[model samples]
Target: MSFRSILHDMKEELGSISRKGFDVKLGHGFRSKSQRVVQDNFVVIDAFKQSCWANMPPELLRDVLMRIETSESTWPPRRNVVACAGVCRSWRETTKEIVKTPELSGKLTFPISVKQPGSRDTLIQCYIKRHRGSQTYYLFLGLSSASYDDGKFLLAAKKCRRPTCTDYIISMNPEYVSKGSSAYIGKLRSNFLGTKFTIYDTQPSNAGAKMTRSRSTRLVGSKQIAPRAPAGNYHVAHIAYELNVLGSRGPRKMQCVMDTIPASAIEPGGLAPTQTEFVNNNVDSFPSISFFRSKSIRVDNCQSEAIPIRKEGMLCLRNKAPRWHEQLQCWCLNFNGRVTVASVKNFQLVASREDGSEHESVILQFGKVGKDVFTMDYQYPISAFQAFAICLSSFDTKIACE
Candidate 1:
């Protein structure tokens, strides 16, 4: 039998037992109050533990789940694995151990994977759709090339502008993008000039991480309603756009300082941090353990003090210089045909060494694929949250850079 069919049958069997096995009515009219209470409690507890699927042999359960995990390798069909996880606690734990992180499997199976590092060599292809009316952006994992095809949703962000700065509030939920919403994960905020930006994570990026004192709470309205959980904004990366002094319009130049990643991570025998699970957003709970968490750096001074181009041992990325196209009369960087119709926002990023040389492999690239639509592909040393925030910066109006 197919794996899904097997699982469905087991669920039906469990449902049947739950409906019939717990039909014993509460107290008998003849029984004393104390005796009835104890008997009723026992019946409730017993029924809770005896939902039919609990009786399945461990060996059989593992074998069935193993088959399901091995069969579905990509999304849509791959959602079967996710379905298995929700079956019960036993199924959820089993699936957790079976599914690998995006760094190893290159598959984003869980919501947490969006916060973890991607595979070193393979690009996780995704696209963004912009809604001008609502000032929101939706990120989706491209399942097919057809623009009309509904892709798997990944993340969403709503642009909020202020007199001094602009904020791109990002969330996992398409319906809610406010800081008070549990779905709020992270955001990108820019300075008055829109030349410098900071990326903030709702949870600590690593153990012993600290939040900036200035922006520890929700940022809008005269009075703030604290989140239902203990969510802190941790500064993970800083982005800066170089100003054009010649007074000529050209492709935007930018650099990103990845504070959490060490420069050595790009060299041989080096490693980058990779998160394995999502943190609990409940106020009563604490962050979950995954890999070693990186120390959080205070970014309160970033706006007042100038950030250096290259840090001592931190990873830095710069825009890949595009070659002048003689025929088209426009500068271009090859996006492997993923990008078309060039605009000033079109750019690819590569890790740069202290010597000012750039790694040939593009770590992240964003470009227009259609009107109100863009393609964002990234891999290695960065999570989808970081990448999406960086792309959002490209959408900002940079009067200085242009």
Candidate 2:
């Protein structure tokens, strides 16, 4: 079908609407609202078309809003709702349900403020109090200042009573800073005294370089400057911990991640005894271990070689984002067991550079997208859970044709 004809057909499908109210068929050889409105009155169609989706139909708006709200999209529905509201009065009424309240969120860094000594509540004291009984939670707390006061950053000492906070993965935008103390970073160090969170600092230079001089020059490249060691330091509990989604913590309750013991797998969580070496030869594929089944894997921060373990009767790998050498088909699982599956999955690997350059990757030569359309950002292997779901959902697809 021609693009125009296909587009026309799609609209015909959309114009048939049964809203909560109007079954009023403004009809006659009228296939849909667009056609009736178009042939009848230029003035009316002009007005209706001008409205776009605003005055069209409440049912349609509800369906669209539901889809947008429930399904995934890069932009916030609030912003889109606001923009659509601006388009026409009907849109404003239809999209009035969009919530635009910005909550406490984003990568956290230091210099958090303490309320005045006599004041009833400071942001830090409030957050600490609210989080008193809390297990790991995903929350955003803001810093009141850009620099520290009297040589100390305020967030430096507000400790979480939960011992688990010590292991909490603290992630932040690399740009947060306290300007005055270039040499006196000791202030920030005190923040970790009572808790167990280790910092995973991202380099500012590593932030996407799509920028102008004004933005690029701001904060003097906050991502790059060497941070001063936090002051009043105690022993570092754990140097590195895996962070879950956007620095979210583990579930409020411990979530169990399960794995199936394939016949070839070795005893569960015991893979070192397996002797499957990393080889590129096409003889045997390394057994696939879905990260979903194994939520977190422990590995040495700095490891020399890939280690294997035997679980069930086969081998299970802890990390999947291996440095794959095509010549040597087997991958080099780098982390000892440190990276979270969510962290690896959520990794924003832009396949192209800011200037729009791309690496040459094997196309794999199949599927809907043309060669090399896949990358860490958009493509992923079939997850173990998905595979199991397919097996359950299928009657014919599961069994291969003889």
Candidate 3:
């Protein structure tokens, strides 16, 4: 039937159903039919019955009632929300779908749990039942510092600004029973340190974990490369190419190598030209790759893979190697570090000829180089380069003076 016709039929049915006989007394105390209005036992229930006997289908009527229950209202109408649910079996079925089988309160929202003799995880189960189809959701947590005044400002200006998720502070449990490649299987405690409150996933988790949208997904920059994979032979070989010092001296530039080393710059370890040979074999005045032994190759700072090479080579002393001045926010990449008797490339420490042909790149050690006396390359296939670079067994930090 047409919707108008259907609505007309429903409206008629709703009008026909008389709640006049349902004594105003029936809604409250179990008063006899003749009970007076003086007692707290009556409902001018025509309004309630009107709500219950909605001319439309029970499903549609229920949906209407649900919207009303959640929308803005002055006097709490849970009673109204509940009263319509009890009119008849059909009505009961619809309302039962909404009213708390067991009501919920205090720091929680959703389907309620009623107490009974049976054991039930009503609170949790009700939530699970609602979202069982969609199994996973992420949570991001951030701890920040802000003054009380900021909190007031935040409450008012939240619509205009965004929260910064730069740093996080949390106390870690001293002990944990881990699961298969995860900690989710174990219990965790969050009696974390003192901090400020701001907008984020501020939802509290009694179970020690809260999930919310604002505190989830972290943003990353495109220039940010992934962490180092397990140190391998390929990386060792890559560094070997970086250490190859054969930059063209005569200003004839080299070409781009793409992701790999340039074909002309691909001399392997133990195959570099020594200083004497480079000076004698001065075919085109290319800087010697095997010219100097590495006095030291170290990985410093938290980058873990920041290879710094303190070796013997022609440094670009005249024009200072470009450097990044943090305070100035200026980048002088090539003119800051050890000299490149060569040119520079995009995101690289390249030593190239005048035509910008790449010759050599700076390479530092791979694995952990500790403070004490441990070798440069221990855990992988990088022994050859170490031997090739070490001219003197030890530099002058110890017994023999330089």
TM-score each candidate: 0.85, 0.18, 0.18
Q: Candidates' lDDT values, in order? A: 0.77, 0.23, 0.23
Roughly what TM-score does model 1 have, to 2 decimal places? 0.85
Q: Alpha carbon lDDT of residue 235, candidate 3?
A: 15
Q: Against the true structure, whose TM-score is highest? A: 1
RMSD of each: 8.2, 26.2, 29.0
Whole-model alpha-carbon lDDT for candidate 1: 0.77
User: RMSD in Å for candidate 3, one decimal?
Assistant: 29.0
lDDT of 3 by residue, 13-90 (tens): 544543333333233211113222332575434333354353458667777656645541212324444444444445
Model 2 lDDT tens row, 329-378: 53333321222232212111111222334323210111111111111111
For model 1, how many clashes? 3
The number of clashing residue pairs in each candidate reads 3, 33, 27
Positional deviation of residue 44's Cα in model 3 after best superposition, in angstroms: 24
Q: Best to worst by lDDT, what's the order? A: 1, 3, 2
